[model samples]
Structures are given as C-alpha cells and as structure tokens.
Target: MAGSTDVAKVYERFISLVREVHWLNRISDLLSWDQQVMMPPKGVSARSEQYAVLSGLAHDRLAGNEMADLLAHLEAHSDELDEDQRVNVREVRRSHDRARKVPRELIQEIVTTEGLSQKHWLEAKQKDDFSIFAPWLEKMVALKRRVADAIGYEKTPYDPLLDEFEPHTTSEEVAGVLEGLKPALVELVRRIESSSIRPRREILERSFPIAKQEEFGAWIVRLMGFDFEAGRIDRSPHPFCSGANGDVRITTRYKEDYIPASLFGLMHETGHGLYDQGLDPKHEGTPRGFTVSLGVHESQSRLWENLVGRSMHFWRFAFPFLQAF
Candidate 1:
C-alpha cells in the first residue's frame, strides 16, 4: 500500500503528464485557428506536417507506458484520492485506453489528412467544384472508419467517433433522441409552411452595412458578458468558437444583404465563447475544468442565439443602436 505522501507524489506526476498533453492539444487548436483565419494559402502543406508531428507527440505522451502505469497505480488506490483527483484519473484513463489502441502513425495520418482536406474543401467551394474535394473527403472518411474500428464499438462505428466529442455517449442514443425530435420538428415546419401569416421581409432584407454589423454585433455580445480581454471575434468561412485557458477565438461570416446571418451567428458563437470563458481557470488543463459535453455547450449557444438574441425584448433595447449603425 502506498503512503499518503507517496500517493500525493504519484498524483502530481500524473498531473504533470496530463498538463503536457493538454498544452500540446491547445497549441494544435491555436494552429488550427490560424490555419482558418490567418495562414497564407501556400502554408497548408507545411502546416499539415506540423499538425502530424504535434499529433504524434501528443498521442505518444498520452498513450505511453509511463502514463499507463500512473493511471494503473492511481486507479488501484482510487479511494485515497478526493473527488476531483479521482474524476481526473478516470477521464484520463478513458482517453489513454482508447488512444493506446489506435496506432500513432494512424493518428498522425489523420491529422495530416485533415489539414489537407480542409484546404481542398475551401478551394472546391471557391471554384464551385465538388470533384476537387471528393478524393480527400473519401480519404478522411476512410481514416475515421479505421479509427472507429481501432477504438472498438459495440453497435456502430459512429458510436466511438461520436464519443470523441460527447464522451460516454452512443450513436444509438443520439439517433433515438433525434428521432424523437424529428416528429415535432416536422410538424412545426409544416405548420410554418401552411400558415397564413407572413413575416415582413423588408425589415430582415434591409441594407445593413458590414462595418456597422460588426460594430453592433460586438457591442451586443459585450453586453452579454463576453470578455474581450480574453477573447476575439474574427471572420471565417464558417463560424466556430475555439477556446483554451484565457484565450478564446470566435469567428463568423458576414452577409451584408442578410441582416440575421452575421448578427445571429456572432451571437451563437459568443454564447459558446461565454461558456468557455466561464470555465474554472484552476482546472484549465484537467478534465475537471473541461466542459461536461457538446450537448451542454450547444445548449448555451442556442439559448443565447435563439432564446435571447431573437427575443423582442432584447431587440427592444438593441434596435435603436442597430438603427443608428
């Protein structure tokens, strides 16, 4: 049996390893954000190599024997640790076990392929050609299937793949929920389509300048509690929120002719940014500090984007400024 001091030392060692892996993942996220937002068109090839190397290094650290031994020891004496330590160990073990089954080479290949595929996707979209991106998309799909097989799923390959984002969840469970919602959603759409009421399109189609749109959106999110000191809002081909520690990046696209596109899009990403910024800073590198699940994250975004951003009361205060801009 390990003494209390010995257990504490082991836990510290485990945390140190966890921190290294966390930092590598965060750095990869930063690079990804740069790739989408700022990287020159010529940098994709080199960036792909960088992503592969980083993915390999991070995978090795998490799935290595040292991490495995630490987890084994801590898990054996889980009673000796507090709630937080135990939770961290359990989550790390879950990831470590899954990662160990997947070859490091496969992980690197997936990362490299992802970078190239994204680049090709953007090009294909710009040129309005699907053929240019189809081959890379196929490669990406095959690689993911390989990963799902490596991880070993019970029902479907998608179960393991979906678990990557929403831990402890299964594709069947997701399908069930979606199926349940589909009926009500279909009914709602049918009602809207058949309704006699028609919205005033001129209000939504009004010419809102892009610069003013940006200004108004920023102002609204600031009031919604997105800390600018720790975050940024930029334009990307698709909207997303990438957050780690104090740095959170939010991106959205602007359509000058469509007022709601950027405004509501920014609101949505800002909702996600707020949730990321609200996480406990002390647990920034550990599972305890991480989000509960993607479902929770999406709830935050949808709550703000639809429940609040679309509310008449919210616009009551916001419309005058919007008109001024």
Candidate 2:
C-alpha cells in the first residue's frame, strides 16, 4: 500500500485520525445506548452535556482542513494506489464528503437529542408502550432526515443512513438484495417448522447462575486475548463494544434460564473490542487507522462469532466454561 516513506507517513497520519474518530464515535454511541438501557435516571442531564462536547469535538476533528489536504494528496497519485489502497482512498473520500457537510452545532444538537431519546426509549420499552416515546422518536427521525439532507444523496432520503454502514451501496440496492433472499428465507422457515428431528432444549433451561455467567463472560474475553489493560466489560440489554483510544467498553446481557445466550454474546462483542484494540496506535487520530468501513466492522464481529466462536478450537476452550456454569 505504501508508495514511499512519504506516502507511508501520510497513511500513518491518516490511520491516526481514523483511530481517534472511531474511538470517539463508538464511545459516544455506546454511552448513549447505555443511558437508555442501563444508566440511572439521575444521570440524564449530565450525560447530555457530555455527549454534546464529544459530538462537537468529533465533528470538528473529521471536518478539519488537514483532512482535505491529505485527501487531495492521495487523490493526486491515484494511479499508484494498490487495490486495497484504492479502496481506502475511495472510502475516505466518501466519509470526508459527509463529514464536511454537517455543522458542528447540528451535531451537538443531535447528540443531545440522542441522550434524551434514549432515556425516554427505555421508559417506553419498560412500559411496553410506544406513544410515551413517540415524540422523541419523531424528533430523532426529523434530525436524521436533516442529517440525510446535509450528507447529500442522488436517490432516496434514507440513502445517507444506509451509507453510514456500507460504502457505495444504497437503500434501493439493499432492498433488492433482501427481496431476492425473502423466498429462500420463507422456505427455510417452513422446512424448519415441518422438521421431524427435535433436539431437546432442556439442557440449556437448567439453572444458570448470574454470577457464574458474568465470570464465564469475563473468562471468554480473556481467552480471546482482548486486553483488559486497555478495555473493560459491563452488562446491558443488548450487547455491544465501543471506546475511545485504548479505553474500549463492552456490554452484554445475562439470561439465567439459558446457558449460551450471554456467553456467545459476550464473545461477539469481544470480537469488536479486539479489532479496536488491534488498530495501529501510530495512526491513532486518522481515518485510515480506524476500520475501512462499518460492513468490515460487522465482518469482524461475525468472524469472531461465527468463524472463531463456533470453531472447534474456540469451543474446545470455551465449552468447558459454559459447561461449568
């Protein structure tokens, strides 16, 4: 990927910026999610202010003039980029464009709104009621619509939201892909419902202690080589991992009646923690230091869950812990 030491240096700076962005954005989103699902009611106003500051900082960082210079430098030598390098440049440009459009004030507003919406969403979900949170949801939708407008799109208004996760792919394209898979999914569900072989699920329904589950979750992340020195874990309704710099945070839920639920979910988030941990520290503030895109980020999570967590080797080490619980 390097054209010379000069190009490599440029990439180092790029990676550093990306690392900072990933850490900041991930941490911001995770905390907001936690405030909704776990945090105490008293913490809301304080958390909203904290989120606004973080939102402003990240927006200013990504949209700075230096990113423009670096991007132009890379663009000037487009012919020299290797295949992966080419993809990196293309992805960075796409991100830079979106970052450039939104004002920091608007970002701060969105961040504050996120905290407020999440706080209310928890209350609504707890009550099994939507109307209680409908106003917040509606505001969020309007904010997101403003975001989509700022980001600019050729087709639908939702394209910007979909673009956040996948590069160069649109809402319509995703719709088409999902449409094609629907029939196959329907048939698969039908066949599973009609199947004669019924494996006993009682093994998992036996008593599972919460403390033991927590210990097992901690033990599994360690086995996966996720650094406790730089990152940590906690409990949440739905598990996720995120952080700023080395201080990554991970969360998971416990199900006392089920054995596999929390264990695998913990490992699934740990997988994401490892990627953030593995990113080059030298590129700590640049976009390239972060993951190339969110699809690739999901791949990292899926790889750990499906490719590693499900593997014989991974299970060889992990199944014992679950069995103990």
Candidate 3:
C-alpha cells in the first residue's frame, strides 16, 4: 500500500509539472492568435519578440533536466499508472525527447522567423505578388530544413517536420495515401464536369450584408454544436480556429458580394472549434486533452464543411434562413 501511494504521489507531481508546460504553450498560442486576429500592424515586431521568448521558455522547461528525470522515473514505473496516466506520461516523454533534440536558440529563431514570414505573407497576399514574399518564404523553408535535420529523420528530412504535426506519420505514408486517392478524386471531378444536371450558381454569388452574414454564421455554428459561452467567432484576413478547451476561438473573412465565403468558412472553422471545445476538461493542459493530429483535426473541419454544410439536406434546411437574410 505504501509503495502504491508513493507511485501515485510521483505521478501527480509529474502531472503538475506537465500542467505548467501546458500553460506556457497555451499562452504562446494566445499570443499567436492575437497576432493574427487582433494585434495592430505596427505591433508585429514586439509581438514577434514576445512569441520567440515564450517559445524559448517553453522549450527550456520541456527539455530541462528536471523534466528529464521525472519522465524517466514515470516511464520506468509506467505499469503502476492507470491507462490515462500512462498515456500522459508516454506522450510527455515523447515531447520531451523531441524538444531535447533541438536547441532552445533554434526554437526561438524558428518562432521569430514564423512571425516575420506570416507578416510578409499577408503583404504578398494583399498585393497579389509572390515576389514580395519569395525571400521570406525561402528563409522559412531553410530554417525548417535545419529543424528537420536537428530532429533527425530515418529516411527523409521532411519526415521529422511532418512528425511534429502528425505524430507517428511519415511523408512516404502520406504520399501513398494521396497517390491512391488521386485517381478516384480525378474521376469524381470528371463525372461532375460531364454531368447534364446543373444547379443555379447565381444564388451563392448574391450580395450578403456583412453584419447579417455574421449573425447568420453565428446561428449556423450554434446549430453545429459550437458552445458560444466557451468560444467566440471573429474576423481575420484568413479563416482559422485557435485556442484550446473552454476558450476556443474561430475567425473568418467576409466578402460583401459572396455569400458562401464567410458562411462556409464559419462552418468549417466551427467544426474545428467544436473539437477544441469538446475536449475533456479534466484532462485539460495535457496531451490527452488535445486533438490527435492535424490530419484528424482537418477531418473534422472537412466533414462539417463538405459532408454536412455543403450537402443537399443542409441546404434544404438552410435555404429558408438564407432567404430571410
């Protein structure tokens, strides 16, 4: 009984430390979210520095010797934990190992570069000129290549980078999936193009007041099970979902003349918002509380965007509300 109690105590302590790391990451995410959705254009430099410093601090904590010892102890006594505890320890250890491989300075550099690159991307997009962003994009790619090398890959440099967002996945596996899918997708597109049946496309292109669209988008996402009390929607140049459990946020851009742009975008981002808001609060600030991977995350958004939002059944139900607008 005493041995079991000691193990439990050790597990709790490890979890507490993991929670600290989670909080730091959450703060970093909020800073990024603000940079995209709310920060002033002139605030870019200061925000970039803040992002880099927070990123470095988080990396230091995750890769520190204290975390190393705790993870090693938890791994050695993993059998003593329940399934959830065991999984948390396993994931934290994996993250620790990966973080330890890359230098803190490199992590800071990557974060800073990402902030600057995004600013450049926004400018390039506004001007509709790739040349304006080419240099920054090239620099980011090189930095990422360095990151991939630092992390070490068995087959290709891309594998390590892909693994960051999609654990246990390899570039080759993704390529195989895409290769298998391409033929079917191409055939489906061809069939659609050749079909005699056609639907009116003019309705979707009709003018929609931005304010009304915002109201309609809010209503639609509510129907999709997005908790407004725990989440909010805003506008950005591009649509994205951010934040974690209990504070999820989504943003979408509205075109005054295009109804589908903000409407469908809201649906898509709401799908991601639902996933974030639905996470187990008890496991908040832990790996188990997070979505598994970007692919899985994207699946939720696409499912809502395509399988539900774009479906005939949904349009049948939505047409009335849309007409009222």
Candidate 4:
C-alpha cells in the first residue's frame, strides 16, 4: 500500500492529467464558439472535422484506463481527501464512468452530427423551412438515444441525458415540477390578459442605432458586475455566452428598429457571463468551477433579463439614458 505522501503525489498527478483534459475541452469550446460567431460560410466542413478530432481527443483522455485507475484509487482512499477534493474526485469519477461507457467513435460521430445539424438548423431557420432540418434532427435524436442506452438508465432514456446536464435529475422529476407549475402559470397568464393595463409596445419600436445599443449594453453589463477585462461581448445571429472563468465571451444580436430585443438579449447573456466570471479561479478546469446545471444557468439569465432588467425601478433609473437614445 502507498504511504500518505505517496498517495498525495498520485492525487496531484491525477489532478494534472485532469487539468490537461479540461484545457483540451476548453480549446474545443473556443473552436465551436469561433465557428458560430466568426468562421466564414465555407469553413463549416473544416470546423466539423476539427470539432470531431478534438472531441475524440478529450473523450479518449477522460475514458482511458489510466483515468479509471486513478479514480478507483481516489475512491478507495477518499477518506484522506478534504471535502472539496472529495467532491472533485466524485464529479470526475462520474464523468469518467459515463465517458468510458460510450465508445470514442460514437462520441466523435455525435460531435460531427451536432455541428452539421446546427448548420442545417440555421439554414432552415433562415429559409423558414422545417423539412431541410428534419433529417438532421432525426439523426441527432437517434444518436442521443444510443448515447442514453450506452450510459444506461433506470426509468427512461431521457433520465441519462437530463443527468448529463443537471446531475442526479430525472425526466420524471422534471415532469412533476412542470405539472405542478402548469396551473399557476396558466392562471397568471389569464389574469394578465384580463388586466386593463396595457404596455405601450410602440415605445420600444423607435430607431436605435447598433453602435449606441452596443455601448448601452456594455454599460448595463458592467453595472451588473461582468468583468470586461476578463470577458468580452460580441455580436452573433443568436445571443449566447461561452467560455468559462477568466475568458468568458458573450454575444447578442442587434435590430435597428427593435430596441428591446438587443437590450434584453444582452442582459440575458450578461447574466450567464457573470456566473462564469464569478467562478473560483483556483477551481478552474474542474467540475466545481463550472456552472451547476443548465436549469440553474437559465435561472441566472432569466433573473437578470426579466426579474431585474424588466423591473420598473431599473427602467426608472435608466430613463435618462433611454431618452438620450
């Protein structure tokens, strides 16, 4: 058996390898981000190939026998670790186990298919044609089903996929929550429709230049505590936040005749950027350093965009700026 010092050394080695894998994953994310926001139209095929290669590399690193051994050792001696170290080990182990269950070829295929699907999706959306995207959507669904089966599940195939993002959640649990909320949501909508008060929708239709919108968005996000030095804002066809921690990037679209679209979209993406920027740097490249779940992440965006950004107090405070524009 290894001594305490020897065990610590092994753990540190394992952490180094994990960090390397995470760096590769981050690079892959950056490539996809560039493909979405900056890559030229002719670069789709090359981008898909690049994504597939990177996905395979990351999956191999995560699913290798070396990782399996390290995780087994860590699990056997988990009592020796600090709470945070134990949590990291557990999360890493979960990821490793899931990755090991899925073949590398399958992982690569999913990445390639997703890239192609996204391209077709954008084209279909632009053309307002569902048929053009139907085949890709069908392919993606079949691939996801295979992935779920490979990962294994107790109740439903969707359980594995839901767990992938939310960790320890199930489709049944989600359905239950949605079922409970349905009546309340319906009542709220009905009440709003029956209310005498009506918003002046045309107020937001006034001309707003893209440059001024960008400047205003920057100001709002800065106030919301998004670090411009550590992050950036760009324009994309659809608004999104990408990257993690020290290098977060967010994008929003602009419409010359629709002020609220860009303004609210920036606020939404900024919320996501703030969460990414706020993660502990020491925990970078680890599960603890990442957003907790997609649902939780969406909550942050909705909080900023709806709860705060749409509040009367916020607009009242910014009324001067709104008038200036």
Local distance difference test scores for all models:
0.91, 0.78, 0.88, 0.88
lDDT of 1 by residue, 1-325 (tens): 5477788999999999998888888889988999999999899999999999889998998999999999998988888999999999999998999999999999999998988888889989889999999999999989999999999988899999998889999888888999999999999999999999988889888888899889888998899999999999999888899975589999988888897999899999998999999999988899899878888999999999999999999889889888887
Better of 1 and 2 by lDDT: 1
lDDT of 1 at 91: 93
Q: What lDDT does candidate 1 reach at residue 263? A: 87
Tell me the tens digit of each residue's lDDT in model 3 across 1-325: 7867877888888888788888888888888889899898888889889988888888877899988887887778777888999889889888999999998988888888888788889999999999989999888889888888888989999998998899999999999999999999999999999999897888888888999999999989999999989989999889999888889989999998997899889999998998899899989988888778998999999999999998999999998997797
**Model 3 alpha-carbon drift over 4 Å, by segment:** 196-199
lDDT of 4 at 274: 87
Backbone clash tally (model 1): 0
Question: What C-alpha lDDT, on a 0 to 100 scale, does residue 183 get in candidate 2?
Answer: 100
What's the ranking of the predictions by lDDT, best on top?
1, 3, 4, 2
User: What's the distance in Å from true for residue 108, model 1?
Assistant: 0.7
Deviating ranges (above 4 Å) for candidate 4 = none
Question: Per-residue lDDT tens digits of candidate 4, residues 195-308?
Answer: 999988987888888899888888898999999999999888789998998899999989998978899999999989988888899889887677788889999999999999
Question: Please, what are the lDDT tens digits per residue for candidate 2 over residues 1-325?
Answer: 3466677677658656755666677767777756845688899988999999887877776788887888787778767666656666777677778989987888888889877777577678779899989999889889888999998789888998887878678988889999999999999999999999787979768778989989877887898899999988887767877764587788888888985788778878888888889887755544545665677777878888888877879778767767876
How many pairs of residues collide in each model? 0, 11, 0, 0
Give the Å shift of residue 281 in candidate 3.
0.6
> How does residue 213 of candidate 2 score in lDDT?
82
Instruction: Estimate the overall C-alpha local distance difference test score of candidate 2.
Output: 0.78
Model 1: lDDT to the true structure: 0.91
